[model samples]
Target: MPDAIDVSATPSDLTLVQDEQQRTKSRELSRAPFEAPPAIPGYDLLHRLGEGSFGAVWLAREKRTGKQVAIKFYTRGQGVDWSLLSREVEKLAVLYTSRNIVGLLDVGWDHEPPYFVMEYLENGSLASRLKEGPLSASHAVRITRSVAEALVHAHGAGILHCDLKPANVLIDGNMDARLGDFGQSRLVTEMSPALGTLYFMAPEQARLDGIPDARWDVYALGALLFHMLTGAPPFRTPEAEAKLAQARTIEERLVVYQQVLEASPAPTAHRTQSGVDWRLADIVDRCLERDPQKRVANAQIVLDMLEARDNARAKRPLMVVGALGPVLFLVALYWIASTVGPRIVRTAEHELLQQALAGDAVSARILASSIETEVRIRQDELVDTADWTYVRQMIRDSHQRTKDELSQLNKGNFPDAELQLAFDKVTNHIKVLEQRLAQADRTLDESWFICDAQGRQIYRFPDAGKSLSESFHWRDYFHGRGEELDESVPHDKVSPRTKTGVSLAYLSTSSSKYKVSFATPVWDEDQKTVLGVMARGVHITDLLDQWEPQIGKEGRPDDRFLSLLETRGNRPHLLDHLRIEEALKRVGTQERGEVILRVSPAVEKALETTDRLEDYRDPIAQLDPKFDGPWLAAFYPVGNTGWTAVVQERRNLTLEPLGQMQGVLTRGALSAFLVFSVLLGVLWYFLHRASL
Candidate 1:
């Protein structure tokens, strides 16, 4: 900000100049309580200020609110009609904002005649100010720019001030202009029934039923600028003005308007003058174009030009700042970081740990919810594989045929050649049944198998060309010759088989391992006989691995790991053997004669209660030679499947909110400063423009 800008002083204080009669009329006073008809009943009439063509404006006080106001009363004798007075009020209702606009205060049409209640301006109109003398280029641009801003506000709201002129614009105590008098204004969507003051109307605006356009106001502003600069109307010559005045009715006026103003461009008032600003003159001339299309597009563009004029003059100090700002910003940023970075990091360290821990727990909980569905699917697979009666019939027929063949051979009822042929045919039938079973019992990590009531393996899917080397009865799920449950080994919860029913049993094929299997005894359709045991095994790790990426993008984070843990026994075991990459685990027990890694305390605690646990601290460097601690851990129990999902994380894995806040605040402050400086420079430019 420039030193000349009195930041301590308000904008209102700067606009008030030393003048007497002007100041007296501007003064406001409360009126004594009064009541009357044909007059504003709620207001005390202080004194009559001025009278327009149809109404009389008075400086008065509203008795109820006690606020000083300018009341324009429609005196029936002033040659005014209800439409003009009503139109003014309707326009103000839709278009108004900003201190630069003499806004509507209150209105009344309840009496014999209505009146306008509006914000009172102390400095009067620009026409009154111009009576003293011509304004300098700075004062002219500032005043015009202020009015342009008001026009922008009005146009944005779809109202065009078609009758914009010096008399309709009021200047306040701060020398800021306020636009008023919307009598001739029209909605942007409506055609004009009448033109505004002839001197200010654009060529198209003068025509009856003229469609509303933004260029109408542009022409008025140019006329205002021209009047401010040259102390005359914007017309090329006095003859052109006289010619427009000679036209009488709407039709005659249209002809003269075309002959004079629209015939050709002539000497504009600014061009005829010697000591005028060419830049401002050119803008005014463009606005006064006979063709509306050639004029400036909108009031906002004129405002931008005026603002740009001020900006161009005040570019000196801003250039200096632009040259050195980045260098200083970098240096200041470095200094602030050195002074405050550690404290910020310390405060954020604890928060980062908590966040990372939360991410771990959340990811684990998500993965845990998926386990029940997988278990159910495995159960369904088991039931589906065992439900085949054809395979069971083939096995029964093979056993029965073997028995018959042995008896026949013992009875010496067949020749050696005949016996050999019958044996080969039975073997081929068994092979065909094995191939059919293999088609139905295939998976990512499971195979199909069948055994006789004696625990001897009979059929296997992938071992179609070979014989079973081991009996499945050794597995716990197949205890008691695949029919009876061991007293020590409880029935599998998932699709467990009944002694004489068709249900299938699902259990761990290999104890303390990721291998799961479903087994059922193939029974006769009459429920009278058990054929053999049928089983399909799937490695649970394959399911876990397949779901990891789909759930929270597990294992993608450097500081985190996701593991599935089984919690069925005294201690939990990693289903996938997910241990610290290069670290050894402390084992507490052996499962199925193999030393296995156990779940961390966090996971064990989760299994005991609450299905979820957080805040496990393990040194990452110890876990992985490539990384270091402090790593946080969390786990979720997968719904009675006795498996848990555990997520791990380290300090380096999460975002740094404080550091990002620091950068945002720094850039924001720098941007705010630049904008503030430019505004102050613009205010300083008022002095330069005024001098010119």
Candidate 2:
């Protein structure tokens, strides 16, 4: 989910056909006769589209009608009962006219390997489309619905598409689906169906011995939907497959298969982390139910659920608008202009100010909640990537080699080229890591550097511009002022919770920006003794910048009204603030270290009070011409961090509303504004929920 599988970013084998060169390469598995076409009596074989284990399917022209069509040659004629082929022909005849399915145009029983001519679809298979990465939610839903409809038709016709995967779902010129490749299909009356593609295969189907039912396709539907949303199939690992393949007996195979079934790799945790629509994820979960009896009754049930979810999402905004009407109506009729009109206006103005104050609190809460979510998400990314086997190995290999080189240098054996080569590998490895981090769902990712076990710097993104002997043994992260903790002695942590021990810091030697720097030890596979420390940080200023367009919407060009995070450290510190305003510029101009405040009434009041909005003057705000003392402030805590999103505005500027003339037009505007606050409250509720 972090790395969205968008249509333009195909991954590995899921890559779609982009050019003739790729098409040629894809046919590396194509076993279709290159020199001579299958001897179909009337149809002239054109070019091969693709081939499978059983036979090759080709594009051909009908001599009688001069119409382009696909011809499939069933080459394995040695032991396949001719009568089973005859039964398949009969089934195909019935399915040829079904909607959302590949149409069968004609059949030939007299060729060297019997051939059948079907209509040609040029676009390609779903596998090829997925090569472009994961489809969008709408496209995924539509495609699944269409395929479910096709499954319904096949199930009704007493035929089972035993193998249902992206490769079998073909697309035509219009991007409409056509369920093709019925090579593994069997009549529904069979006691047991053939094994389908393992990734999409239902658990019971792994036994290849069950009374055929519609639930088989139901499971496949879920797997297909999962693939579309998540890009990769759940638990589709070569290692798992190879283990099953290597099992020597039915008992051994069943044990391994049952393990896989119990794993039930659908609806992965990563999928949940992706923030996909819950309704869609639920549909996939239902389809992937491990117990066949507990799964959705049929493909039709899944389709019905999908459509219902879509309808509900479509009506959400309208539902929200309607729900706000009653509250607004009550506020609009609070009082009329008459004997008590002046008092009424005053009270209304009071309520309006209260609402504006509430709005400030809401805005701050939104920003805080969003930041908290970002922190948790980024931490998750850091942990997941840091724990990856290949990543750990790469880091260890580079660091271990560097340590060995340093040891040799200490013994006075100068292996200059070898040492340079070792450093070069470390540098190159860091470069690769940085590139991957760039592609990952990182926030800012200012720099990623690593230190060897001896506290010497090994790698930095900009190459550190320093010699390999440079050590960070005195830094706070490595050694700090704690007599009990032992400054020179070291310890390490490797897991998720441990990797997220981020401390605040300012960027650059000039301290022009702020960031959250996390230093966690990289360990061997067993997570024992530390091999090295990998440090990652992102400039928190970039977070403020990202919210600029939204935050600046209601404020002036100079950004008089702005939001920032304040942390209650030894004293209050502006953890991350935009430097666009005067007060911030005056306080945050330090060339080194962070700006930590000892005393500020505005900040203290906001942190202590539960009130949505309040007013206070900073003691330091009046010292300079550029600074403003009085502030219209709003505050809220961020996910138990003792950090708050604080929005501060120049006091006089925000009080303009109270200074407006008491006139008919002015009254109307105030009334309208109050009424709109009800609607705004509703909008905020939804937005906050979405952010969470």
Candidate 3:
């Protein structure tokens, strides 16, 4: 270049420099002043609604149509390119006829800053509603249904609302929902990187490389529903990046949504509206299901379920009233019988039989004048001869005499026979005197008569002389082979008897005399089979008189001692003083028949060790050989009889103590009602202020 510059090379280098300068000048000219698109003549911009990274929305009024519209301006200087504006405008135009989608009314390329006008909505967006608080279940369902319907339509139209979220849904004055912002929407046929709000994007979308599908809209809808119900979007944390990482897994996103639902309080509208059912809550839950496949396939299914729920709720009040009416009537009848019926029967028995028997001159006067007088005189004579003090001193003296005699008998290897004889004489005398005193004090009353198993009258007491032949029969001792004597049969129809001729049945012997009999079976020493029965027959008049005093003034039947008797013979007699035999007889059948199991091994062992065994309370009821009912019975081996004593009551009646506790519960319920009323008043006042 210094040596007169190779002329050809110099010329080529100058041409290259001119071409580079021309290209720089062209770029500068392209970047120079672009006037904002001339506002379509008469159209006027009012106020800005929002501004974003790519565009700004301005409320505008159309001069010709006199219509309000949202003009979205995409200024190249404001970080938007021509391509993005054109794509968004095209998507909006395509979705114009969709009821769920916002429509593009017009576009202006005449403006330096290209813009498009969309139909204006006044009620703002779902995101704004969520910011106030969670929506009620019904409102949440309604919004979700609309959004899903729009997604279904979009998906069918070969489009995906890749950026679906609460912010993209607009509510109008009538609360009608519409979707907006198709800026990020893509044709389903396109293969592109995922682009959407991180929190609302499905796991597949969060991957940044997967193809989007209808499920993408499903996941976004779930996220939006979660926000509407919980007042916060799922996976939205203060640490944005960390929260976005968690949203990558479908399971993790679902867990977040579930946690929000569990933590959220039930809606206030539900608490205030008594007629509103809880089934609406189920719809919200279904929409928010983590698995896109599990959610209603589309909005139609959700709408169908909601309609069904509404119909069910409408019928509930009438159904409840119909069911409760019959229950209340039955309860009233039971209460009357349980409380008042027993008292009436007890009063009738006392008035008719008890008073008459106690005042009867023939029976009472005979006992007072003859038998009782004889017993008292004999007792006095025995005491005069050997008072208790004298008897005690004599016993001690005889003990010493016997000991001396025994020592004398043992003096040699074989004691004197005479000394042994002397000791035996003193012991025999003492035994005889003891027997005399026991007999004198017996003082048997004539109110009832006693008999042996053989139907033999045993020293006829005053009432015992009524009859020994007709009243005391062989059938009375041995439960015979009558139709009522079947072991599998219930005592409802069968009268039980003891071998002692104590008839559980009311036997009409003489014209005005009725007897109530109680019997105990007499068994052999081995206690295997019953040999006879020991019976006590009381004049019905006298027995009723005795029971009257024990019956309290409350006038209820005394259910405590239910006297029953059964025989141990081949036929096995059964009897019940409570007169429940009629009911049992009516219920007689194989299915309802009684069953008897032998005593347990443990119980048999206990019996062997003790002569008199008393099990006051048995946990398990022993079935009668001929009756069914849980009975608390006492078995006593009377002489040689296989006899037992039974007393029973219904199980529910045993819970009398629990019934008394209802008063405390009633008071607690009253207190809770008062508290709830006060809380309701406070809530109403606050809600009124909130509405204002």
Candidate 4:
């Protein structure tokens, strides 16, 4: 049977609430006693299926055919609008042949209580099924599409179901939609007004003078779909219902309805529902657009869109594969040819460079150890000379002389002949030691000097011809390994002497070259008291001269070089002899001749705390902006000498093979891509011609 208007349906407005209460009152008055069954020729009345204010629907069976049907009896003069009934019957008659519409049988207009018969759909209405919960997206969309197809057929017949809702949509025995309840139906050409259910009604249709429009049905369809998917009509909230009840007049209620829908946030629950996607969501959103101009034009277009959506879903997998095929193939090519191949070459090249750098670091360590040994030997020579019996006796005999005689000798006065003769013997012994030290190593050109206990230099090699003119008190070698060795301390404060001390590197006053002194304290025979200090100096150039032949050797590239840095004072200073010599040769002795060269800040930062080799940029490389360095370098500290040895090599030579391999990989990828494209093009050309 066609669905009865659900008396249980929630009322929308203050007027509808009063109308529903009145209908409830009338239903009680017209139950079976007040309402009489009209006798028909071949049908027997079964029972009252449902009742409304104007009429009641009863279940009946044709006696001869034994077929069930629903009869809606319009009670005469019970506020029945005969024109509305006429319009509804006319619309149904036009859509009689449509399978999606409920079949209308017979109508008796002149009967005491006029009635009409409709096919009995035993499964009831969509609204009854929806009371359980929201339907799944698949089920909901399927039902929505079926209803839309019915609308398309109706619209073609110039009919609009203005009151479309779940209750109006009947589910037949086969569970297929059969649109019915066209009480508010209008022909497309009619200007008469129709108001659908609240929240489902379009804003334009809520106006008192609203005219019939197809978009009104579009909005109802969206609301119907939304209800199926989310279990409630969009904007039909408890709060909205309460506000709607507050409106006293039908005009006020209609205005409030429009306001509630327009002001509320658009419905989005369907978007997050289990099986809903953007495509379906978009269709519902378009149909529900508040502005009719923006809404989907008609139900036919809605049906067409739904069909397209279904077609798209069916073809999605094929489309995905077709779109992603080339991208996946290119990714494979990059993995095999570009990434793995070049990475292998780079990794192998990196390992080889590390091995070579490690070997270089070892070589630097060896050179540093050799320098330490040589310095130690020189210190031992000085200690041995200081321990000489004749040298100690001469110092003792000189100290024994009167203070007046010592002062007079220093002032060049021969106050005592014996003291003068003792000074001469000490001077002669110093000259002999100086000659022996010079012959021992030709690099030792700086004079060896002897300082008395008072820190006065009484003798110098080759004799500067001045007696006791210089004081050696403010020297790090003179003091011990403590803070006083800085050479900035007062000369009067004598520090405890070291066994053997190497002074900080300083520029030679005479030769204008960097030199360092090795000193040992001379002692009395009992070794209880220090008599004086004896020291010899060697030029930095002489110390680094050992590397002269090693620099730029046959296998050593010119870009690779070694350097020495004095790791004392405020910052590390370059003491490389090769660098100093080059500068000297360029300037020809006009420069101050300081061996140390300050490095760039970047290089100094790298050298600040590192004690081992690492990748290094040549400090001087920044002098020329064009140099791309990234040199591999090793730094080894020369033992206890306050100097670091550096061995550096250009990195490009080591990575040259890797660079070539990368180039080959890049070219190969491009070539493979081009060939693949060409092959595809040729294959497509042949296939095209074959199809023709």
Candidate topping TM-score: 4
- Ordering by lDDT: 4, 2, 1, 3
Model 2 lDDT per residue over 537-563, tens place? 666666556544444524363333455
The residue-by-residue lDDT of candidate 1 on 383-423, one tens digit each, is 55555665564455444334445345323354456454543
Tens-place lDDT digits, model 4, residues 193-308: 77777877988898776757778899989999999999998888888889888986667888999899888999898888998888899999999999764577678667767877
Estimate every model's Cα lDDT from 0 to 1: 0.58, 0.59, 0.47, 0.71
Q: How high is the lDDT of residue 557 in model 3? A: 44
User: For model 1, which pairs clash?
Assistant: 15-174, 138-689, 138-690, 495-504, 496-505, 621-628
lDDT for model 1, on a 0 to 1 scale?
0.58
Evaluate model 3: give its TM-score: 0.37
lDDT of 3 at 585: 41
TM-score of 1: 0.40
| 143-198: candidate 3 lDDT, tens digit per residue | 87777777767765767777777678888778978888776777754555445654
Instruction: Report how far off residue 571 is in candidate 3 (Å).
Output: 90
Best of the two (1, 2) by TM-score: 2
Q: Quote each prediction's TM-score.
A: 0.40, 0.42, 0.37, 0.46
State the local distance difference test value for candidate 2.
0.59
Candidate structures ordered by TM-score, highest first = 4, 2, 1, 3
